[model samples]
Target: MNPSTFTVMEGEDNERIDQRLARDMDVSRTAIQQWITSGDVQVNGKEIKSNYKCRTGDIIEVVPPPEASPLTAQPEAIPLDIRYEDDDVLVVNKERGMVVHPAAGHASGTLVNALLHHTDALSDVNGALRPGIVHRLDKDTSGLIVVAKTNDAHEHLAKQLQTRSLTRLYIALVHGNVSHDEGTIEAPIGRDQQQRQKMAVTNVNAKEAVTHFSVLERFSEHTLVRCRLETGRTHQIRVHMTYIGHSLVADPKYGRSRSSPLAGQALHAETLAFIHPRQQEKRTLTASLPADMQALLDNLRSG
Candidate 1:
């Protein structure tokens, strides 16, 4: 394991070493605490506990094992709901609550882990952690995601995303009756300055995010809408919809508190279209709403 070093910034004043390590290293604080216990973590060349408060100019060092890296995904026996598969590409209807790749607080049972179990032919362009992952959906957002089997395919698919040729659509059940039948939301999305864990629509270091939405159905209080993303920014659909006063129902992060049977924010990746890597053919894929969302809609319709 190669040692990595970082100096505490002024903005990190009085932050816990483990918290800083998690942010800097992108590994969970649990893993960081283990490193602290093993004496693999040091501050200013002296050993310190995970809860040690960091001050400006404090140099921290970490030596972590490769297996403990958030980037290394191991194969698991989890089953995958594959929608389409070819030699060069594979499209899977990722289930809700499954992390797309290994990350902080999510080391296993990820889609990447299942993919590794299914095949060893995943493209390495995104490195060991992501492997063949071309795109991702939020953990609670169930939907279609494409994977590349070869580096050539990964590049081809990525170009489509960069050029805005790749199409992604989502079903969003949002709060309040949407006043308009259809509209476009063009906003810049960036990390929430106050809460680092959440995203917000802001011009400060933000990126162009455009979502075109149309009402699919309207209930007494909520509106079910279809969202088309022109630019894939982090939390684009959620943030944009919330920016327009229609945050998805049950969204723990950006939504108003409400009671619902759905396990997560009522959002689903319903469609994905792109040019095939090998065949150079345009392909579109779709998935039905999961049981929870469908059931919720059914109940709403009945009521």
Candidate 2:
């Protein structure tokens, strides 16, 4: 790309050159500063510091460097618990604390990193960082998640999820005793207005969320439940359970616990059923509760 020229409009006068260029060119101020340091940005045909204030009618030229790729998702030698794998799909019992894909601040030790190490045949429909990820399991919640080996498989599995044909079942330990044996929670979930890190049941920019739960066991103060999801919203089960006054045990964001032995929410993806993308056959897979959650239950029963 050629150098872009800009004239400092009246309102932008006296603004920092880096800020002005970033706003005008719709690039990051960090990139603008990099251009300034590299002598790619000029004011009135002379290179100037990023802090230089712009004046009205000042001519600025910017030659942006080639767009740098963000951090690459590296393939790590992390072992994956493969539940099922074939030509078109792979299903893995994602363990607790394993992130499903690479993202900001969670670049490594993710399932994607391990998947990359295991196979390079991941579908790129979700882009490089999230290759083959048809859906995601929350970092703290462990369980079965499907990955696509090809773009066609990716689209097929994604359509199943959208149409609610991809069935996902979870085992959740909640804070309070659930009175009913089985019930359905249908609520709208959205990002919490006050708490940026939390999702809440609200109508503001929310999506329809549904969770069907049946009591599996009951303890003195907690209840173990089996939950099936009909919609895959972010934090759907966690938010819906909390909305029904049965927040997951040890859920850092939703539960009231300040300290607990568990690493994260007492929830796990126990079962997953989806049609095989290539074979067109129904596939159902399941995994038992993780050790930590199991230990918690044992202690509760013993007490």
In model 1, which runs have C-alpha deviations exceeding 4 angstroms? 1-71
Kindly report which residue stretches of model 2 are placed more than 4 angstroms away from their true locations once superposed.
Answer: 1-69
> Clashes in model 2: which pairs?
none
RMSD of each: 8.5, 10.9
TM-score leader: 1
lDDT of 1 at 121: 95
- What digit string (tens of lDDT, one per residue) describes model 1 on residues 1-303? 567999888887798887888888777766686577445687886667566999999999887856574345799999999999989999999998999987656779999999999998999865566789888899999999999999999999999999999999999999999999999999888767798568899886677889999999999999999999999877889999999999999898889986778778899999999999889789999999999999999999999
lDDT of 2 at 234: 81
Per residue, candidate 2 scores C-alpha lDDT tens digits across 4-120 of: 989888887988887787787777665566567446787786667667999999999887657521335789999889989998999999999998876546758999899999998
Which candidate wins on lDDT? 1
